[model samples]
Target: MGEEVHGPLAQTPTPSAGMQKIVTKHSFFCLKGKWKRGRHVVVVRIRSDRMCPQKFVFTVGVVAFTIAITLGGQVLADRFELANGETIEGTLLNPNERPRRVWLVRSSDGTSLQFDADAVTHVTRETPVQKEFHKIVSEYPDTIEGQWKLAEWCQEKKLEKERHDILEHMLELDPDHVEARRLLGYSRIDGKWHKREQLMAERGYSRYRGTWKTAQEIELSDRAEQTEVAQKNWIVRLKKLRMLVDKPQSSDSAAKEIREISDRHAVGALMLGISKEPAFRVRSWYLESLSRIATQEAFSAIVQIAIDHPDPETRLSATERLIVLGPHQAASYAVASLASEDSARINRAAEVLGRLGVSSAVDSLVNVLITVHTAVVSDGNSEGSTNATFTPSGGGLSMGGGAKRIKVESKNEAVLAALVKLTSVNFEWNPTAWRSWMATRQSPADCDFRRD
Candidate 1:
């Protein structure tokens, strides 16, 4: 599973004619009922049926051993930190063969060691590539154009997160950037809002889907399981929600009733209820109803929900609804969330901004990139300073990743991608490069955020 990838068939050489026949037979009939292309196999011959079974097990064992030799190696290169202030870097193996209380992690150069929760500080896999990227960004934090080129390259290659971070950096360098703002979904037509379909018709160009939820997704599989309101009167539902927000004992019932309501005046009623709803739960439900209604007025009501709601979840729901309605203007809702302090909310905001690629988020994102990390070393220490220049080994602009995570590393990674996406620049991971870039923009582009 380490960097040294070994193909399954790497060890097994092309079988001889006699062996090939048995292998072909084993592949087609013994293993799978039908022959599959590119499947590998090995075969052995036996003189008698009694000897054949014993030899068969022996042959399988031999094949397994061969594979082990091909894939496994004693070259341990993983790094481990100990509680005793000792650091070791070597190949670490976890043989999950037998149940043993004391697990062993041997070093590459014939050094034996064991892990204990209290004794080990940390363990990490060797990622030369990541280290290299870190180095490059650290070196040219001021080379705004170079980072921008890398960001654009990442964008072209569909490296969404990486591209995003590069753009964010570019924005940090040049906030009023037309291309970055446009790419980031900060579209404005004569100071009016525009969405995905407003500028681009190609669904392929869109990062995410318009329909966050399909028809099947909205429908309740078992409506019978819904909480019984125990009240059939529509007016009573309205009265319950017109109460305190934190004290929402009756709002749940009110929401359930409002959700099921389907009449010509339902939208009007919901909108009115949203405006008057004192309970946050009921207000959240009103927004839900508006979303379900899916009308022009519904969008307006959702926006109102975003503006008026105190609950973060309610505002987030409003944001998602607005984005689904018009992603071109998703940045409209996203910028507000980016300004929030909650980590979960900030992460969601970052995602929304990532898709928008709007340059409007540059300042906020730069603030995040510079501020949000836990410094490995504190200030006032010369050794802790990050001002030293660096150069990537075997210099070549390259960045890519598969699925994303949301840990501290992943959060910073997301921010980096966002900076790239917003500014169409690859600061790689240099806040200083971004700051330098930002300081140079005098006559800014017309990409500053404004709402209708």
Candidate 2:
């Protein structure tokens, strides 16, 4: 009769007039009827003339006590299904709050009946509608029409997988089922099936078809996606990457193709080719592709190209592309390259920063000179004689296909050239001069303020 709505819970709507009438009638007759019915009520009709008065009184008291206990547990209404498949709807009376081995149900006809819970197969709490659905589905579990009904119910309930499963079973039973395909979208035609959009597109149907395509169309769309997924296999992409490495033209064409690929597998294939291709030109091509890819991984592969590859032209090409990719945005990579002991990678990084006009390289260039000066520099070294100890910290400089331990500076070259190009100032052979110039320079670090 009374209900309270909590904040989290929705307000329970009041029952309709028709529902209230039915419930009010059902609750009263279904509970109080047993007392009015002389048949199943007290069972005290057998008047014993032979029995003692005290004994009769005790027997009547016991009967009343039993009835009181049964009535105490009754609810407004419930329905019980017996083992024999017979159902009884009435006010419920169970000794325990939950249904168990024994139940006392009082019917609307004023008859009370005790039922064994074991004999009752079901005790519905929410509604009998759930039981009805279960009974129908259990009775015809594998039937096409039965499953169709279930599928419809599932769809209405927004039970996606359950609805799809039911539809699949229906298709198994009848493969040519157009309704199933229509709901799912996509249908087979002459063996080679067409997509929903293609099918709907290739033929003009009534405006009655409306904007919503059938399930058959959706299935065709799914099929196309699956085909695309298949085409994106890593092995297939790897082969394509390999073929495209030299195709149309080198660097430019390969770079264009690599830029276009969005698939993860294709990216992996391109990276793999960059690192593993045995031929210099092939690896070079892959290197160009990675640069255009313009990802962290692509940047790393390009750095590796500069590190491990001996080809100057390829390294220059990769470095040129790298500078155009925002030198400041790629500052960390340049720093990492400079930190390396590889001569080729160092030179490439210097070149890249210089091309980008990154004046900040001056300090780095000065630091490199100061660090290696003791090891690589010689006294009065105008004659170009030099000696550098090959240590783990400072790798032997590469020259003429050999790891050269030393090279004399004629005023300054290579790395210094890059520093001078960037800062527009040359310290020549004086690392201290470069440092002093850097500290005193009034212009911004990127400014080309040198009086070259």
Overall lDDT per candidate, in order of appearance: 0.48, 0.52
In model 2, state the lDDT of residue 178: 75
Residue-by-residue lDDT tens digits, candidate 1, 1-452? 11222333223443332232122211100111111112233223222225443221112111211111111223234545555544433345664525434334543333233444455466666465433332243233344576566666556656565466666556667776677767777677787545555455433332224543333443532232232232234345555544432366755664566665554235656766666656666666767667777766666666655544556666667767776776545566666655554444555566556655566677777766633422122234343333211121212222223212221222456667777776677777677888787767542532632222
Give the least accurate 10-residue stretch of model 1, judged by summed lDDT: 26-35
- Which stretch of 10 consecutive residues in model 2 shows the poorest summed lDDT? 20-29
Q: Per-residue lDDT of 208-245 in model 2, one digit per residue for the tens?
A: 23565556676676777875575467556566656666
Hey, what RMSD does candidate 2 come out at?
A: 24.1
Q: Alpha-carbon error at 231 in model 1, in Å?
A: 15
Model 2 residue runs over 4 Å out of place are 1-236, 240-259, 278-288, 306-308, 342-345, 373-389, 392-413, 450-452
- Residue 429's C-alpha lDDT in candidate 2? 75
Candidate 1 matches the true fold with a TM-score of 0.25
